[model samples]
Target: MYRLYYAPGAASLVVHWLLIEMGQPHALQRVDMDARQQKSAEYLALNPNGTVPTLIADGRPLYEAAALVLYLADRHAEAGLAPAVGDPQRGEYCQWLLNLANTVQSPMRLWWYPQDLHGLPEDAVREAARRRVEAAWERLDAHLAARGPYLLGERVSAVDFYLVMLMRWTRKMPRPGDAWPHLGALAGRMKARPSFAALYEREGLSEWR
Candidate 1:
């Protein structure tokens, strides 16, 4: 069984939702942020970054939500959440996932924790990060307009799960994820899934539903 170290509705939610989507058996170990449990030696031993959504797979710990999703999707190919290796779509699949991580998700770090980036006024840094996020949404919205109902178009993939959760993080922003037409439609479809409702219950998330 896989084990996930997470905090409710955090980055861990993506992994949690994917596992349920794949019908994978997993155990959750919450790292209490209120208690600073993530910084404790034990938790740091498992994940040096002390971040949520670390998965322990086959007795080894894995960090990074994107990597974990990639691993799980590939390993459980029968779930059909990833394009198989050598499939023509595989390259595009990797590109979308990596773009989600490197382009948008990195900026999310600064958006959520402006204190991490030094030297500038925190508010300015946050505003800059917010712009980056909105730009990402605009690009993604266009992509969805052309190629989506899901990220892979017609068939849902793990990348779609990742996208929905990332968009959820932006729910409180000035122009939220759903403000874009395609993204709004995509979010609506994703939310209609049984797994999404279960995630809301599992994470105790009452807002943005």
Candidate 2:
């Protein structure tokens, strides 16, 4: 059986949703990040990075949400969450998944914790990070506008999960909806999925709506 260590609201949600989509039997261990449970020796041994959403399968631990989601999808190809190796859309699928991590995800992190990225006080750096986030959101909005539904057309690939969680982070920012209509719509669609609804219910997250 696979074991998934997760913190509520963390990138681990991507893995959790994927596992549920795949219909995999897994144990979910909630690591309390606020309590520093992730930094404990046992958790660190599983993942030295001490990050949630770590997967332990076959006695091996896998970190990083994107990697875990892709691994689960590939392992259970019958679930149809991942494109086959030779499929034409495979390239686009991989590209957008990684792009979400490298481009959209990174900028959101900067906005969330500006002091960590800029090595300055939040008071001194928040505005600069917010401006960068706004510019990034504008670019994301335009891209989504051109693409229509889903990052890669109609199929709900792993990229959607990443974007769903990332966009949720944006809702707390000033005027997030006003700045990015496409992203807001995408988030709404993601939340509408039964899988996401089940996850929210299981996680006891009343704020998902």
Candidate 3:
């Protein structure tokens, strides 16, 4: 059995959703980040970064959302969240997976911790970072618009899980809905899934609305 350490509204939601979709039995351990439970020695032993969504599988700890999803998909290939290595779709699948992690999610970090990325005390610089995030959102929105439901059309691959988390994070920003209608719709579709609803209820994530 796998043990997943998670927190509501965090990237852990992606792994949580994947586990549900795969119908895989796993333990869900909620870490209270506000209470600093993630910083404790016990949790630190699991993940030095003090981050949520740490998965302990076969006594091995797996951190990072994209890596976790890939690990789960590979472990349960019958789940169809990932394509076989030789398949043509597999190339596109890997491309989008890396794109989401490296391109999409990385830029959004600046908006969250502008001071950490650039120095503090400059309203103009903050606004510039916000604009950059918005621009990235536009690109994602266009990609979704072209692809039609899901990042790869019909199949809800691991990339969809990545996009779902990204969309949720973007919703909290200023002018939230201005850039991505398709992406927003994708998030809504994922939320409507029974698995997502069940996880939301279990994790007390009703505040997501």
Local lDDT at 47 for model 2: 94
lDDT of 3 by residue, 70-109 (tens): 8899889999889888987888888888887876677676
Best by TM-score: 1
User: Model 2 misses residue 123 by how many Å?
Assistant: 3.3
Candidate lDDT (C-alpha), each: 0.89, 0.79, 0.81
**TM-score of candidate 2 versus the correct structure, residues matched by position:** 0.90
Candidate 2 colliding pairs, count: 0
Model 1: per-residue Cα lDDT over 1-209, one tens digit each: 99999898788989999988888899988889999998999989988998887899999999889998899999999999999999988998999999999877898879889999778799998899999999999999998899887788888888988988888888888888889999999999988999888878877888888
Residue runs of model 3 more than 4 Å from their true location after superposition: 122-126, 177-179
Give the alpha carbon lDDT tens digit for every residue of 1-209 in model 2. Answer: 88999887788988888777667888999999989999999999999988877999998999988787778878888988778899998998888778778766676776677768555777556676667667767877788899867777777777778778777766777867334788778888888788887788777777647
- Candidate 2 stretches with Cα past 4 Å from truth are 117-119, 177-179
Backbone clashes, each candidate: 0, 0, 0
